[model samples]
Target: MSSRGTDVEDAVDSEVAAPARGTGTRRRVGYVAGLFGLLLLLLLGAVVVLVAQGSIAIPIGEVLRVLTGQDAQSQLSRTIVLDARLPKVVAGLLAGAALAVGGAQMQTLFRNPLADPFVLGVSSGAILGASIVILGTSGVGWLSGLGLVSQLGVTGAAVAGAAGVLLIALGIARRVGDPVVVLVVGVMLGYLAGAVVDMLVYYTDPDRLQALATFTRGSVRNVTWNELQVIAVSCAVVLVLSVFLAQPLNALLLGDRYAGSLGVNVRRVHFLSLASVAVLSGITTAYCGAIAFVGLAAPHLARGLLRTADHRVVLPASALIGAVIVLVAEYVAGGNGLTKTSLPLNSVTAFVGAPVILWVLLSGRARRQAG
Candidate 1:
């Protein structure tokens, strides 16, 4: 064929290929979007059920009435639904979403599907950080009595602690380049942080120990509206910030070298991602205690359900899935009056998280070095 005719044929082929590529991309996006819609519905249903079926067992109709500012059957039902169940539900929602998003980011940043804030001891660091302030200030009667100030102080401390551990883990991963080694280092750091917390607890008075005990076990039931305000505000800020991280993180998924070639600052992306993980994990730990496995399992579940590692889809989907998991866990752990004695959140999350960890190990993902 003449050179001009060959060029014309190539142009036609290129035009045809473009539409097929666009169609495939649109199909994937649609699938993920549909999954997200379903997840949102599940989360909504879980919230309604939690609010209506808690210890007092308010009817769904009554709960809806109180929520919409309409009158319930009785003043007592209104008080129970509005005052008590609402805050716990809000806390669970925010905390779950925060952890899941953080996990998605961490998994991407570390390039390990198994990496999660809680699994790597980031939560332990937060607990230790909050313990210092809670223990140190307990002796000062006036300081301990300063409610909001004291709460913020502890929250701030927890954030700092989580950041410290995350930085250390990232540093080690940078040096070692081995995901397994870095994972071990994170566990050691967590144990070290926990050891320090134990020392502080030993010196703390009996009165203080009771509070620490409750905080360590992880429960959303005790979260008051004031505390929920702090968790909700902080989580909302970090979650929004995470939206910006999503594109960079998806770039990093290819490998630091490829991401850098694509104009991504690998170091800067790593820093910001780990920082977000720290904030999400720290604040949740400070308020809800070190609820486990939500961080470790939710991202994996997001990926599995959506069948893609695209952070744009995975991040939000993970958040909704995490919220559902935590709310359901709370309900099963006696929030719904299934049992008189409440169980810790970790107890429930472990069932989901442990198997995921095992799958990662067995699947050879953990054998690869960090990217």
Candidate 2:
């Protein structure tokens, strides 16, 4: 009788363990699925808000109608919705996602919480590249007439500039044990790029200066449908590449040695990551100007909210959050109802980003040296 009772208890224990494990697995799966759903909903909401609350306030119903297979409100509304507002929203969505993804990868690459896409001088390089094109072009009077070659050339130069900075920063980071030192090195690289941009601007024609100023401050209002085509194609290519890199990036978060043990080629991952980030940052800066903070803040916010340092989640999550932040900023600054003039994208973003950056610094997260 004692032996039989023991056997029955053993069977119960086994049954309980199986369900326990199963329940845990289901919970985790549900949590991740829920987060993904929330992100999708947020992005959808951002699109709705951006379209509905523009300079000419289109009704939510109208926005929904146009989004569906419905007819045009007017030729003007149709053009505005399809041509102007939609492209701007799309550009914001893409640009935000690109910057945030790049920035999130950068944080993981550096193994530091505060690392952002612009920290490694990508934005400055892009600005320098775009400035050169603007100063040299004849067809675009003061940044007015950039054709495809010039745009591609600018994006290429920006990518080159970004790659150059990444190589240098990576070298410095590898040699330096302290995260603070690495961040300082990044800052210096940015300053150097900014100095170069300044020198180019100084020698540039006064007529060209206006365009340079606009690009540096950042704005999505000026992007036409044709220019957006370039952005869409390039961003789509880079984004797909990002999805493929996500798993490898996860291995990396466990440390280079561990990743190597797990059969990940760290060097190849680094090279590909640098290229991907360069393309993402460069193309966005070329089209929309150097919009700051989204790259810097989006990843940080996503990680904080998700409570995981894992890049696999951080990367896509950052993209979705970035789209939300940028579109909201656009609505605020798009000169819809409050005023006739729009606010600079940089200005609105910095207002939020600067404080978060300061918080990081004050909390010693940015200042901490990796031991």
- Local distance difference test, each candidate: 0.85, 0.81
lDDT of 1 by residue, 1-371 (tens): 69999999999999999999999999988887788889989998888899998657888888888989997889999998878898989899999999999988887777666778877889999999988887767444312344788889989999999999999888888898898888888889989998999988888786767667777888888788878788888899989988888888888888989999999988887877787888899899988998888988888888889888878888888999999999999888877886778888888888888998888776674456542
List candidate 1 stretches off by more than 4 Å: 1-26, 139-146, 365-371
Model 2: lowest-lDDT 10 consecutive positions: 138-147
Give one clash count per candidate, in the order shown: 0, 1
Query: What does candidate 2's lDDT look like per residue over 1-371, in tens digits?
Result: 99999999999999999999999889877887798799899888889777777668888778878888598676676677787788888999999999999888887788865677677677887777767777788744424576677778877877777777877888888998577788888888889989988888788777778777878888877777888898999888988888888888899888899999999999999888888888888889888888888888888888777777777787888889888888878878863546778888888988768887887677674456642
Cα shift from native, residue 92, model 2 (Å): 0.6
Cα distance off (Å), candidate 2, residue 285? 0.5
Go through the candidates in order and give the C-alpha RMSD of each one to the true structure.
Answer: 3.4, 2.9
TM-score of each: 0.90, 0.91
User: Residue 226, candidate 1: how far off, in angstroms?
Assistant: 1.2
